[model samples]
Target chain A: MKVLVTVKEVAEADDDFAIEGTDIAESDLEYDLNEWDDYAVEAAVQLAEAGIADEVVTVTVGRERTEETIRMALAKGADRAVRVWDEALDGAFADVASKVDLFEAVVAEEEPDLVLGGVQAADTGFGATGVALAERIGFEHAAVVNDLDVDADAGVAHVHRELEGGVEELTEVDLPAVLTVQTGLNEPRYASLRGIRQAQRKEIAAKDLSDLGLTADDVESSLTITSMYEPESESDAEMIEGDAGESADRLAEVLREKGVSA
Target chain B: MSVLVAAEHRRGALRDVSYEAITAGRELADARGADLHVAVIGGDVDGFAEDLNRDGVDAIHTVADGEEFDHNAYQAALSQLADGIDAGAVVLPNSVNGLDYAPALAEALGVPIVTDAVGMAYDDGLTVTREMYGSKVETTVDVAGDRFVLTVRGGEWPPAEGVGDAAIESVDVDVPESGARVTGFEEVGGGDVDIADADVLVSVGRGIEEEENIELIEDLADALGATLSASRPIVDNGWLPKNRQVGQSGKVVTPDVYIAVGISGAVQHVAGMKGSDTIVAINTDPNAPIFDIADYGIVGDLFDVVPELIDEFA
Candidate 1:
C-alpha cells in the first residue's frame, strides 16, 4: 500500500510578539514542522519499515520556505515530497474546502491507498481539513486517532480514536482511508546525520496551482480575518517579582498560607 | 430559517457540551430571527429529546440510530435534519466527535465552516472570534454568507437551563452504511494515582525538558507534601504516567492548590484543571495561557526557579 502523509509547516508566535495587520509579525513567528504532523510522518514511515507500505510520500500546501520543514520529514523517512502553493493562498485563510481541493487534487494524482495527517494544525487549529478531504474524495476517515494498526491482508486499519476524557473508541476502517493522527500516537524519531545527508539529495517537487490543474479562483477562501489582536489579559495573578530565590521564598510563603507544606 | 444544534451523548449520558451547544444555538437563532431546533440522534433519542428541551428551544427532533457516535450517521442525519429545518446556521459543540462530522456536514451542505469558535456575532452576516497561536492572539473571522456551520468551544457558553415547552418529533432519515465500524471502547489512565483525589498538586509539563529532570519536580512534590502530576505532553512523552496527567483526556483535578511548572497551559490541559481552588504558574513565557487562570505566577525559567523552590521548602 502507498501512504501519503499531509505535512504542514506551522508558524508559532513568540511571546510578546507584535501583530502586523491580521497576523503576527513575520520576524516574530517561528516556523517548524507541526508538532502533530511530525507524529503522522513517523507513523507513515513506520508503515514502510514494517513492510505494510511500499512508499511513504508527503504532501504539503505551503510556500517554498516550508521546504526546510518538509525535508525534515524526508530526513525522518518520507520517500519524497509534494508542496503546492499559489499567490491566492498567500494572505487568505484557506477555508476547509479550499484545502480539501488541493489535497484532493494531489490524491487523484498520487492515487495513494492510504492518507494520513495531523488532527489539527498548531497555527490555524481548524481540525477539519482531513475529514473534509475524506468527505470530498469519498473515503473512510477516523479523526483524532491515537493508535493505528493496519492489517494489510484484511485491508483494514484498526484505530483507537481518542475521544474526550480517558476513553478510546476502537474502530476498524477499511483501506483507502484517511486517519487524522493525534499526538502521543508515536514518538517521532529525530533525523539522524546520515538521514539528513540523504534528505539533501531527495526530491521536493514544488508546484503552483496550475500544475495541479487548478486555478487561483478554485482556492479562494470564503472566510476573511476582519481583525487580529492580542487577547486582553484577564488574569488577576499576583506575580512573584524578583530573582529565583526571592520568588521561591514568596511562592513557599503562599503555599504555606494555603495550608500546604511538608 | 432556523438554527440547528446536534446534541451529543455517549454511553447513555448526554455530554455537557450538548447543553452548551443549545445555548450557542439559541444565541444565533435569536440574532437571525429564527427558531432554535435541537436534534438528538441515536441511542434513546426519546429520552435525549426531553433533556434537550431547554429554554429557547422551539423543537426537538430525534433520529433513532446506533447506540454510539458514528460520524457517517451524524453527517447523514444532521445534513438531512438541517436541510429539513432550512437551518441557516448550525451550531455544534467543538468536541472530538463534533469535529468528526461538522466539517463533512459543512462540505455536504456546501457552506463554510468555522471551528472552535469562542465568540460569535450575527449582524447582517456572521463573525466568529477564535484563538490563534495557541490562544495568545485572538482574531475575528468574517463569513461571507449567513449560511455556515460553527463548532463552539466547550465552556465558552453556559449550558442552557430551564425546560421549555418544545414540540418533540421523530424524524425518519436515511443513514448510509459506513466503511468504518466501531468495535469497543477502552478506558485509559487506570493506574496507582488518581490525581483528582489529591488536595495539592505539583504538576510538571514539557518545560521539565528531559526525562531525567522530572526527578526535580518529584523532589519539589515531596518537599511541598503534594502529589506529583503533569500536563498532557509530559504524559505523552512517557516522562509521567497517564494517571498523573491533568487534561481533557486525562483526570480532571480540582486540587486545593495546583502548581503548574513549565506548562504552557494549552486549552485541553486547562479544561481539566481550571476548576482547581487555586492555581500557581511557573514558566519563562509570561504570556502562557496557564498564567491567565493562575492565581499566582512566577515568570522565570523552571530550571532556575524549581531548584530554588525545592530549597525554600527544604
Candidate 2:
C-alpha cells in the first residue's frame, strides 16, 4: 500500500501578533511544520516501518520556504516529498475551498492508496480542508481519527474517530480514502542524523498550480476577513500575590467568600 | 429566506449543542428577517424533532433513516434539505459530526462557510467572530455570497428556550452509498465518573509533570470533595484515563467550582471548563492565559500550593 500524507507549514506567532493590512505580519511569525501534521507524518512512517505501506509520499502547499517542512517529513521516514505552490495561492491560504482545489490536483497526481492530513492547521484552524479535499476528489473520508488500521487486501480501513464526551466511534472506510488525523494519534519520531543525511539526497519535487491545470480564477474565496484584533480580557481576575502558602490561604479565603468552601 | 439549523442527535436523543445551534440559528434568522427551520436526521427522530420545537423555530424537518451518523447520509440529506427550503444560512454545531459534514455540504451547495464561529452578526451579509492563535486574537470575518454555512462553537450561545408549536415536516431523500460505516461507539475511560456530573473539578495539566504527581491532585480532589479531571496531555500521556480529560476533543464540563492546577489553560483546555462558575487557577506563570479567566488566581507552584490547599481543606 502507498500512502500520501499532506503536511502544512504554519507560522508560530510570537508573544504578540499584529495585523499588517489584512493579515498578520510575517516578521512576527516563526514557521514550522504544523503541530498536528507531525502526527500525520508519524502515522505514515509507522505504517511504512510496519510493512503495511510500501511507500509514504508527503506533500504541502506553500511558498519556496515550505520545502523545509516537506524535508522534515522525509527525515521522519516519508519516501518522497512534493511541494505544491503557485503565485495564485499567495493569499489563498485563508480560503479552504481554494486550498482544497490545489490539494485535489496534488492527490490526483500522486494517486496513492491512502491520503492523510492533520485534522486542522495550527494557524488557520479551518479543519475543513481535508474533508473538502476528499469531497472534491470523490473519496471516502473521516475526520478527527485517532486510530487507523488498514486492510490493504480487503480494501478497507478500520478507524477510531474521537468524538465529544470521551466517546469514540469505530468506523470502517473503504480504501482509496482520505483521513484527517487527530493529535495524540502517535508520538512523532525525532529526525535522526542518518535520516537527515538521507533526506538531503531524497528528491523534493515542486509543482505549480498551473501544472495541475488550475487557474487563480478557478480557486476563489467565498469568505473574506473584514477585521482582526486582539480579544479583550473578559474577566478581571483577582491575582493573589504571595508565596505558595500565603497564596493558597488567600485562595481558600476567596473560595469561602464565594460560598464554594465552608 | 430561511435559516436552517441541523440538529445533532445520538441514538434518537438530541445533544445539548443541538439546542445551542438552534439558539444561534434563531439569532441569525431574526437578523435576516427569515424563518428558522431545523433538520433532524436519524432513525426514529420524531421525538428529537418534537424536542427541538423551541421558540423562534418556524418548522422541524425530519429524515428518518440511518441509525448512526453516516457522513454520506448527512451530507446528502442536509444539502437536499437546504436546497429544498432555499436556506439563506445554515447553522450547525462545531462538533465531530457537524464538522465532518459541514464542509462537504457547503461545497455541494456552493455556499461560503465560516466555521467555529463564537459570535455572529448579520447586516446585509453575515459577519462571524472567530478565535485565532489559540484564542489569543479574535477575528471578524465577512462572508461573501448570498447563502452561507456556519458552525457555532459549543458553549458560546445559550440553548433555545420557551415553547413553540413548530409544524413537523417529513422529508424523503436518497442517502448516497456511504464509503464509511460506523460499527459502534466505545466509551473511553471505562465510562466511569462522568466529569459532567461533578460540581467541583480538581483538574491537573502538564504542569503536574509526572504520573506519580497525579496522586497529589487526587489527594487535592479528595480534600475538596471534588472529582478529578485533567487536561489532554495527562490523558494522552496515559497518566490518567481519557474520561478525566476536559477540552474540545474531550468533554465540555461546567462544574460549579473548577480548580485548575499546573494548567496554563490552552484554548482547547479552557473550552471544556470555561463555563465553571468559579475558576481558581494555580500556576507559577503569572502570564498564563488561565489566570485571565480565573476568578481567583494563585501565582505559585501547584506542588506547594496543592498540598497546602489539601491541608487547608482538611
Candidate 3:
C-alpha cells in the first residue's frame, strides 16, 4: 500500500505573533512543521513499520521554509517529498487554488491507497486542504480522526472520529481514502540518528502546475479581499491580591458586587 | 444580491449552529441590502427547513436525497446551487461537519474561503474577523472576489430571530461522483452537558496535583450546576477527557460563567474560554493572566479555597 501525507510549516506555538500593517511579523518567528501534522506523518510511519503499508510520500505547499517541514517528515520515515513552492501560499490557501489542482495531478499519478493529513494547521487553522484535495481528486474522506488502524489483508481501514459531547464513533472504510488525523491521534516519534542520515539519501520530488497540466487560472479565486486588520484592543488585565483565604472572600464579594453571582 | 447560507443538519435534524450561522448571514445580508437564501440538505430536511424560514431569508433551497449528507456529494450539490443561483456569499457553521465540506465547496466553486469567522462585512469585498495566535491576536481578512464561502464559529455571533414566511425553491442537483461511503456512524457520548453550550463551566488545570483531587472541582461544579472542563495538560494527563479540554487546540466555548480553578490561564487555554460572559479565576498565583479577563478573581490555593467556595454556592 502507498500513502500520501500532507504537511505544512507554521509559526511555532511559542513564537510571539504580531500583525504589522497588512502583513504579519515573519521576522524573528521560528517556523516548524505544524504540530498536528506530526501525527499524520507518524501514523504513516507506524503503518510502514508494522508492515501494514509499504511506502509513504510527504507533500507540502509553501516556499523555502516548507522544505524544512518536508525534511522533518523525511527524517522521521517518509520515503520522499514534494514541494509546490509557491509564494502566495505563505499568505493564505484562498489565494492559491492551483495547489489543489497540483495535488489532484499527483494523486492521479501515484494512485495511493490512502491520503492522510493533520486536521488543522496551527497557523490559519483552516483545516480545509485535506477535504479540498480529497474532493478534487474524487476520494472518500473522514475528519477529526483520533485513531486509525489499517487491515491491509481485508483492504479496509477502521478509524475513530472525535465528535462533540465526548462522543466517539468507529467507522470503517475501504482503501484509497483520505483521513484527517486530529491531535492526540498518536504520539509522534523523534528521528533516530540512523534514520536522519538515511533521509539525506532519499528522493525529494519537485512539481509545479505546468507539470500537472493545469494552469493557475484553472483554480483562481472567485471572491475578492478588501483589507486585513487586527482586532481592536479591549481592557487590560486586572490583577487581584492577598492570601488564599482573603482573596477568596474578596472574590465572592466582587462577584456579588458585579451581580454576576450572590 | 442574495446571501446564501447552507443549513447544516445531522441525521436529518437542523443543528443549532446552523441557526447561528443564519443569524450571522441575516445580519450580513441586511447590511448589504441582500436577501438571505437558506439551502437545506439531506433526504428529509424540509421539516427542519420550515423551522428556519425566518423573515430575512428570501427562499429555501432543498436538496433532499440520501447521498446529500456525504461531504463530497453535499459539497458538489452546494457548488452547483451556488453557481445556479449566483449567490453573493455563502455561509456555514464552522462545525466539524461543516468544516469538512465548506472549503472543498469553496474550492469547487472557485470562491475564496474563510473558517472560524467571528465577524463579517460587505464593502467592495467581503471581510471577516478571525482570532489567531491562540486568541491573543485577531485578524480581519478581506477576500477579493464576487462570491465567497465562510464558516462561522459557534457562539461568536448570537442566533437571529423574528420570523416570517420565506419562499421555497426546490433545486434539482445532480449528484456528483462520491469517493466515500459511510458504512456506519457510532456516537461517542461525553458526559451530560457539552462545555460549549453550558452556561457555567468549571475547569481544572495542572495545579490540581492528583486525580483524586478532581472531586473537589467536581463538587464546585455540582454546587453551581456548571459543567466540568479542563486544560490540555489535564486532558493530556488523562485527568479529563479530550472533550473537556479548553484551549486553542481544544474546543472554543463562550459560556455565561467560566470559572478557572488552579489554572494559570495559559494563552492557549484562555483563547478557548475568554469569550465567556463572566470569568472568575481562582489560582494561587496572583499574576496568572486568567485574572486579566476575569470579572472576579481569588488569589488563593485551590486546595484551601475551593471547599469554602463550594459551600458558599451550595
Candidate 4:
C-alpha cells in the first residue's frame, strides 16, 4: 500500500509582524513544517513501519523554502518527497480552491491508495483543503480523525472522529479515501543522526503548474485580499502588581467584587 | 440573489451555532440586498426550522431525511438547496461538522470556500477576515467569485433574535449513500461533570509539567469552588479526562470567572474560553498570548502563584 501525506511550511510570526506589501514581512520570520501536518507525516510513517503500508510519500506546495520542510518528513522515514509550486501559485494562498486544484493535480500523479493531511494548516486554518481535495479527486473522506484502524484487505478504514462537547463518533469508511488527521493522534518520532544523513540521499522532486498541465488562469485564485488590520481589543488586561501572595490576595478581592467569590 | 445559512442541529434540538450562522447570514444578506434562506437537515426538524424563523430570515428550508448528523447527507442536501435557490453565498458555523461539509459542498456547487471567518463584508465582492499565527495576525481576504461558501467562527456573532415569522419551505433532495456512517457517540473523560455548566473554572495547561502537578491545580479548584479544567495537552497526556478538557475540539466554556493556570493561550484553547466574563492568566512568560485576552494577568510562575492563590482562598 502507498500512503501519501500532505505537509505545509508556515511562517512563525514575530510578536510584531510587519506587513511587507500584501503579506507578512519575511525578515525575522521563522519558517518550519506546519505543526499540525507533523501528525499526518507521523501516521504515514507508523503505518509503513507496521507493515500495513509499503511506501510513505510526502507532498507539499510552496516555493523553494518548502523543500526544507519536506526534507524533515523524509528524515522521519518517508520514502519520497514532492514539492508543487510555481509563480502562479503565489496568489493562490488567498483562496483555498486554487490550493485544492493544485493538490488535485499532484494527487492525480502520485496515485496513492490512501491520503492523509493535517486537519488544517497553521497558516490558513481553513480546515477544508483535505476534504475539498478528496472531492476533487473523487474519493471518500473523513476529517478531524483522532483514531484510525485500517483493514486494507477489506478496503475499508475505521476511524474515530473527535466531535464537539467531548463526544467521539466511530465511523467506517471505504478505502482509497482521504483522512484529515487531528493532533494528539500519535507521538511523532524525531529523526536520528543516521536518518538525517540518509535523507540527504533521498529524492526530492519538484513540479510546477506546467508540469501538472495547468496554466495560471486554470489555477486563478477565487479570493483576494482587500485589506489587513489588527482586531480591536475589547479591554486591556489589568496587570496585578505585587509578589505572588499579594497578587493572589488582590485577585481574590477582585473575584469577590465580581460576585464569583464570597 | 439569496444567502443560504446551514442550520446545525444535534439530535432534535438546534445548536446555538445555528443561530450564530443565521446572524452572520443576515448581515451578508442585508449587505448584498438579498434574501436570507436557512436550511435545516436532519430527522424531524420542523421544530428546529421554527426556532430558526427569526426576524432576518426570509425562508427556512427543512429536509427531514437523515437520522443523524451525517456529513455526506448534509453536503448533498446543502449543495442541492444552494443550487436550487441560486444562492449567492452560503454561510455555516466554522465547526467540526460545518468544516466537514463546507469543502465538499463547495466542490459540488462549483464555488469557492473561505473557512473560519471572523469578519465578513460585501463591497462589490465578499471579503472575509481570518485569524492566523494563533490569532497573532489577522488577514482580510477578498473572495473573487460571484458565489462563495463561508464558515463563520462561532461566538463571534450574537445569536439572531426571533421577531418576524419566516415562511417554512420543505425541500426534497436525493440523499446520496455516504461512504461513512456514524455508529454512535461515546462520551470521553466521564460525563458526570460537564465543564460547560461550571460558573468558575480553574484550567491547567502544559506548564503544569507533569501528571502529579495536577493535584496542585485540583487543590486550587477545591479552595475556590471552581471546576477543574485543562487544555488539550493535559488531556492528551491522560492527566485529565477528555470531559474536563476545554477547547475547540473538547468543549466551549463560558464560565463567570476563568482562571487559566500555566496556559499560554493558543488560538484553539482561547476559542473555547474567550467568552468568559473574567479571565485570569498565570504563566511564566510575560509575552504569552493568553495575556492578550486575559482580563487580569500575572507574569509569574503558576507553581508559585497557584499555591498562593489557593492559600488566599482558603
State candidate 1's TM-score. 0.99
TM-scores of the models, in the order given? 0.99, 0.91, 0.79, 0.91
**Model 4: residue B259 alpha-carbon error in angstroms:** 1.7
| Candidate topping TM-score | 1
**Candidate 3 structure quality by residue, lDDT tens digits, B117-205:** 87876676777877655454566777776577888987777766668588876777787655455555654425565778877788999
lDDT per residue (tens digit) for residues B1-314 in model 2: 79999988876668899999999999988888889999988867788887889998999999988787888888888888888888979999898888898998888887767789989888888889997766656788888766888999888899999889899999987987787999999877657678989888889999998889899999888877789999988887778888788987788899889989998898778878889999999887665789888988888878888888777888
Q: How would you encode candidate 1's per-residue C-alpha lDDT over A1-262 as one tens digit per residue?
A: 9999999999999887998899999999999999999999999999999999999999999989999999999999999999998987888888999999999999999999899999999998999999999999998999999999999999999999998889999999998999999999999999999999999999899888999999988898889999999888888999999999999999989999999989
* Model 2 Cα shift for residue B112 (angstroms): 2.4
Compute the lDDT for candidate 3.
0.74
Best by DockQ: 1
Measured as a fraction from 0 to 1, the native contacts recovered by model 2 come to 0.68
Q: Candidate 4's C-alpha lDDT? A: 0.85
List the TM values for chain B, per candidate.
Answer: 0.98, 0.86, 0.74, 0.87
Write down the RMSD of candidate 4 (Cα, Å): 2.9
Q: Model 3 off-target regions past 4 Å?
A: A13-18, A86-96, A206-230, A233-238, A241-262, B31-33, B169-177, B189-202, B205-229, B232-239, B242-278, B282-293, B297-314
In the order shown, the chain A TM-scores of the predictions are 0.98, 0.91, 0.84, 0.92
Weakest ten-residue segment in model 1 chain B by summed lDDT: B234-243
Mark the regions of model 4 whose C-alpha exceeds 4 Å error after superposition: A91-94, A242-249, A252-262, B191-200, B207-227, B237-239, B252-257, B274-278, B284-289, B301-314
Please list the residue runs of candidate 2 whose C-alpha ends up more than 4 Å from where it truly belongs after superposition.
Answer: A16-19, A243-249, A252-262, B191-201, B208-228, B248-257, B275-277, B284-289, B300-314
Residue-level lDDT of model 3, residues A161-214, one tens digit each, is: 765534455667666788889877877889889888888888877776676676
For candidate 2, give the lDDT of residue B265: 90
